[model samples]
Target: MGFIDQLKTEYRVGGIVQRLIFWNIGLFIIPMILFSILKLGSVDIGIFDWTNPFSDDFFSLSSNPVDLLWKPWSVLGYAFLHSGFMHVLFNMLTLYFAGRLFLTFFTQKQLFGLYVLSAIFAGLVYILGYNLLPLLVGQTAKMTGASAAIMAILVATAVYAPYYEVRLMLIGTVKLWHIALVFIVLDLIYAPLDNSGGHIAHLAGDLFGFIYIKLLQSGSDLTKGVSGTIDFFANLFKSRKSAPFKKVHRNTTPPVRNSAVKPKDVTQKQIDEILDKISQSGYDSLTKEEKDFLFKVSK
Candidate 1:
């Protein structure tokens, strides 16, 4: 396959998290390229200009509530736009780590919903902080990045499985909550130093993650709203079809069995037993054989 074709294939099967990363990277690069070309042609469109905070840019959430009236999409669009190379790099890396961890015990729908909801929540909180806080009053700021959504995934995973162990280079093994706490502490410490809006958004994401998991534990799923909205839009774009009329026919041929095909060794009973063990304790409670069996079954 060609390079572009390979990338398309990867995006098709890389799961929701990888698709999200691709989206962020694409939005960042495509706008920059379009902006450069437009500038060269002396075309000054306010929509493509990221430097002007009050301009009609498609991304970057502004602190001014009045600006939101014209750029409502920025609430979620900002998460897909990055300020710089390092900004995208670290955010994408954390997304990969936290996203994979979150998916271990959750569904893809939940992850995507949490990401979207958290970003919107964080953007609103950022704007509110800039507006009401004594230290940030009268300050206007525009923020863009995936840090808030990434933090939501990370914090959600830690809350769901606090004791989950992850080994780091030179630091050995540590619990997931340990890593989550460190990030939260860093955000709190840096909120007053610089990038205060970004830090506030991160904290907002952390709060949303905790709330999402707590509600989930109480048998309330927040992702259902996201899923339903997605389904509605998807169906709106889909072409309707009618069932074809068919006639039933009788056949006298007997069924044939292939001797070459072997029956599966793993049965539903065995799978249920393993799942029960995991539920009663944790994934670590499974034996080597059980883990191997589960892995193979998953494949």
Candidate 2:
């Protein structure tokens, strides 16, 4: 298959995190192509011009009051926007590894929740630092990149699975928590210096991720509120079906004798037991009964 076709196939079968990385890389490439064509025709596509924070079209929540209403969406959109190929590649690589680690413990909804929340917090930190800190340093700046979001995911995954270990190309296997600590420390130390606003943003995202996992462990879900809001709007466009879809109550049916063999019912307790076993001893250690129970429960 051709390169684009291969990418499409990967996107179709890959997890949500991989698909997100593909989409961002794809969007970044499109602008480069457009800019190249414009240059050949003696015209400027003004890609950088549009991206500059000081530019008229630059997206801002505070400076542009109207954008504040739309700023929440920017958290998502900014994740996909990149200035260069290297930038896209670096961010996607970090996302691929960090996301895989994150998914090992978190549900898809929780992963997405952390990602979106991280991006928003990152943007907020950038804005606050640039606007407020400039009073002391007499300088304002703009920031961009997926680093903040990546940091958030890295920290969240570490928080969730501190014992998880991964081998680096040249380095030996290391615990995930150690990696998270390095990033946090780096951001904290550099927040006052070069790319100060970006570092501040990264710290903010990291803080959100850390707090989110803590809340999750206590049985509170931050994502539920965001998901509920999304569902509220989604239901608006859904068409109302006919009343023929009315359901019959199970209580209305009389108990009938079964001729065929019935499968064993797997209760929630059984499922939890299987999960605990898998967590402690790994999936390969499961017996046939446990495997069957897990398969049924998953369905």
Candidate 3:
């Protein structure tokens, strides 16, 4: 196969992470091409530029009203902008693996929520660290990368499937928790020394991911709020559906049956039986009869 064909086959946009990587690379390429054609070589369309958080150019509510409106989007945009080939490669690889791991156990809605929240926290940490730290010594530096968000997904996956194992190129299978520990340690130790802002952002994202998973175990999902926000805008643009509040009344009475059908009550014993089956044989192992019974009872 030719080089272009090989590239297309390997990296064709399909899953969420793959599509995101494609979009990022496309954005970077399109701008460069446009600039080249228009002879505007000096223009920089890169979303995240290294600017002092305290500087007038930084997105801050106190600094400028216009910038404040734009600040929230920067959190998302920064994830797609990379300074070099290696930067994007590393970030995309991390994203692909972490994202795949996350999707193995989470719904797309949950993954989307995790990504957005992680990116937001990462940006917040970057801003706070750059602005408040004396270690910066008033040096104006801007941070941008998807590493923080990728780290968040990685942490969340570890929390969700701690026993899941993956084989490395040289090493055999390794538990997910071991990988999580290594990242946590690296972030904690190196965060204060090199790329402090990025490290801080990563930690912040990781915290959110971990907390989100823990909350989910209790039958509460943080992603529900994010999904609601998406639904609000989607409903606004699309045609409105009839509200559930409307009442419908039937005028005619139905004929009575000779024998009355009794509603089947699910007993505690039956529930225990199902639970035991699930524990021993797994959810997918349940027979059709068992599944139907469980489904009806669940309702």
Best candidate (score: lDDT): 1
lDDT of 1 at 59: 61
Q: Name the best candidate (by TM-score).
A: 1
Model 1 scores what on Cα lDDT?
Answer: 0.85
TM-score of 2: 0.70
lDDT of each candidate versus the true structure: 0.85, 0.69, 0.69
lDDT of each residue in 1-299, candidate 1, tens digit only: 47885676456446788889999888777767777777788886654454432223446799988888988999998988887778889999999999999989997778999999999999999999999999899998888898999999999999999999999899999999999999999999999999999999999999999999999999998989998899887766653553356588887998677676545533556766876676445456689998898667555
Model 3: per-residue Cα lDDT over 246-282, one tens digit each = 7888859886764544433335466558756664444
Error of 2 at 10 (Å): 1.8
- Candidate 1: worst 10 consecutive residues by lDDT? 49-58
Error of 3 at 188 (Å): 2.2
Model 1 / residue 25 / CA error / Å: 0.5
- Candidate 3 Cα lDDT to native: 0.69
The positional error of residue 14 in candidate 3, measured at the CA in angstroms, is 2.1
Off by over 4 Å in 1: 40-58, 240-299
Mark the regions of model 3 whose C-alpha exceeds 4 Å error after superposition: 1-13, 40-70, 240-299
